[model samples]
Target: MQNGVVMEETKLEPRVGVAVFVLKGKSVLLGRRRSSIGDSTFALPGGHLEFGENFEECGARELEEETGLKMGKAEYLTVTNTVFLEEPKPAHYVTIFLRAVLADPNQVPQNLEPNKCDGWDWYDWDKLPQPLFWPLEKMVRSGFNPFPSQSHPLHSC
Candidate 1:
C-alpha cells in the first residue's frame, strides 16, 4: 500500500447475456426496450444470464419472463460482443444468441415487464424496426439470421 493507504481492486468484467430469436414464419419477435440501458430501442427477449445457468436455460427463462411465451427447443446461434459507449453507465456485454420456436404455435407475445419493455411485436427480418439495441444491431450488421435456410451458417446444438 502506498503511503499506508489500502488499495481496492476494481472489478470490471464483461457481463454475460442471453438473447432469443423467436421466429414465426418469415417474421421475428422483438420488443421495444424501456430500460435505462437501451431505452427506446428494439431488442430480443433476453436478459442477463443468471448464476449457474446455461445459455439455453437463460434464454428460456428470459423469453418467458420478458415476453410471457413458453420456450421450446433453443439452438445456439452466435455470440456478440457489445459495448455501450454512449450509455451513461458505459457497460459491456458478451451476448449469446439462441433461436427458439414457441412451445405453442398460437402463443402471443406480451410485455410482462412494463418497466423494462414497451411491448412485443413481430417484424419481417428484411425490414426490422429502427434503432435496434447494440447487440442486435451488431448481429444484423454481421449478417446473422435466425432462419436456418437463409444460408447464414448458424448451427443449432
Candidate 2:
C-alpha cells in the first residue's frame, strides 16, 4: 500500500512571536483580522519575531507595521506559549508581550498586509472589542503595565 502508507518526517521546533500593547495613556490598541486562522479572530498588535532581534524590538517593529505608529517607549510586559492541536498537533508558538506608548496618538493605522487585516483602533481598558482573540483577552485580564524606567525588570504597574 505505497499510496495508503504514511510518510515519516522530522518536525521543526516552534518559533516565537511578540505582541505589543500600544497604550496611549488610558487607551490601548486593537486590530481586526480580515482573514481567519482557525478559531483566532481579532488580535492585538503582534507578529513573528525576526532573527537577531530582542523581544522589545520585535514588538516595536510589529506595532509600526500593523498600526503605523512610531513607538515612544516600550517596556517588557509578559510572555505566553501556545500550541495548536486539532486531530494532529501541527505547530507551537511562544509569544512575548511588551507595553509601548505611541509617539503620536493621532496617526491612523495602515495595515502592513491589507489583505489580512481591515484596521485598528484605540479602545478603553474597560471595553475590549467584540469577537476578541482569546490570547489578547487573557493578557488584558493579567492587569499588566509598563512602568517608567524602574530598576526592576518586571514593572509593578
Candidate 3:
C-alpha cells in the first residue's frame, strides 16, 4: 500500500487471450465462426489462456488445438488491452499475437467443434474477405507479417 491506497491484487478473472497468425508460406489461416457468440462471422484461430500457462504455451497450444499444427519458436508481440466501456461484467481482455508457420500445407484444418466453427481457409495477405475481425484487420493494416525472416519482432520470435 502506497499513498494510503490499498494495492490489492485482483484475481484477473481469466482476462488473457492469445491469437496466432498461422502462416503457410504465402498465406495466413483465418477461420469462420459458426458459434452464436463472437461476431459469428470472421475471427482468428485463438481462444482463452489456460490456468498456469504462459503466453507462448497458450499461443502454441491454442494454435495446435484449433489448427492441428505444432508451433515452433514464437515471437513476443505487443499485448493489447481491450476494455469495453459499456459492458462492465469483466470485459477486460489482453491479446497477444504470435507468428506461426504451418507444419504441413497439404493437411487441412478440420472443424474440431463443428457446432462452433464452420471451416477454415488460407488467405493471402494482399486479398482478404470483408468484415474481418477489427483487431485482425488492424494487424494486417499495421503490416504484421507471419513470415519470420521478414516479419517484425512482434510477428517473429
Candidate 4:
C-alpha cells in the first residue's frame, strides 16, 4: 500500500429527504415505512431528494412515487434534522417537509411499492397511528399546524 496506509472507500454524508404533508379533511395521508432505520413506523409520503432537484419538485416527485396520487404545486411546511446514531448503521438526514392538496379527489392511493411500504391510509392528524417515523414524529411533537383550516371532506377512504 502507498505510504504503508489504507483509506476508507466510503464516506458518511448527510442525505437530503423530502416529505409531503397531505391532508384529506382532518386526516393526513401516511404510510407504514419498511426501512432499516425506522421500520414498521408510520411516515408521510416522501423519499430522497435527487441531485439538482428543488424542494417542491422533490416533494412532489416523491409523493407520486410513493403513492399513486398526484398533487398540485407544493407549499413549504417545515424541516427536521434527524440522526439515527443508535442504529446498526448510523444515518443522518435533513428532511424538508411540504404540504399539498390532493390534485385529484378521485385518485386513491395505491400500494405501488409494497417492498418499501406496507400501504397507505388516511389518519386523523391529532390521533395518528402509533410508532411514527422519526422525522414525522418530531414534527408532530413540535405542535406545528401545517393546515390552519381543515377541509372536512364529506366522504373519504
Query: How badly does each model clash, as a count of residue pairs?
Result: 0, 0, 1, 0
- What order do candidates take by lDDT, descending? 1, 4, 2, 3
Of the pair 1 and 2, which is ahead by lDDT? 1
Model 4 poorest 10 in a row by lDDT: 148-157
User: Whole-model lDDT, candidate 1?
Assistant: 0.86
Q: Candidate 3, residues 1-157: lDDT per residue as tens digits?
A: 8799999876645377898877776777888776434445567788888889877788878777776767765676566667643433436667887766655557787666666666778888778776676667666687875565644433345
Give each model a TM-score.
0.87, 0.77, 0.73, 0.86
Candidate 2 similarity to native, TM-score: 0.77
Candidate that would win on lDDT? 1
lDDT of 1 by residue, 1-157 (tens): 6679988866668999998999888899999999768999999999899999999899989998988899876799778787777887778888888997888979998888999998999999999999998778877898877787855533445
93-131, model 4: which lDDT tens digit per residue? Answer: 998888777888677999889999999999988898999
**RMSD to truth, every model:** 3.2, 4.0, 6.6, 4.6
Tens digits of per-residue lDDT, candidate 2, 33-104, equal 764343335677888899999887788788887777787767777778877654144667788878777668
CA displacement after TM-score superposition, residue 51 of candidate 3 (Å): 1.7
Q: State the lDDT at 113 in candidate 2.
A: 67
Every candidate's lDDT: 0.86, 0.71, 0.70, 0.82
Residue 98's lDDT within candidate 3 is: 70
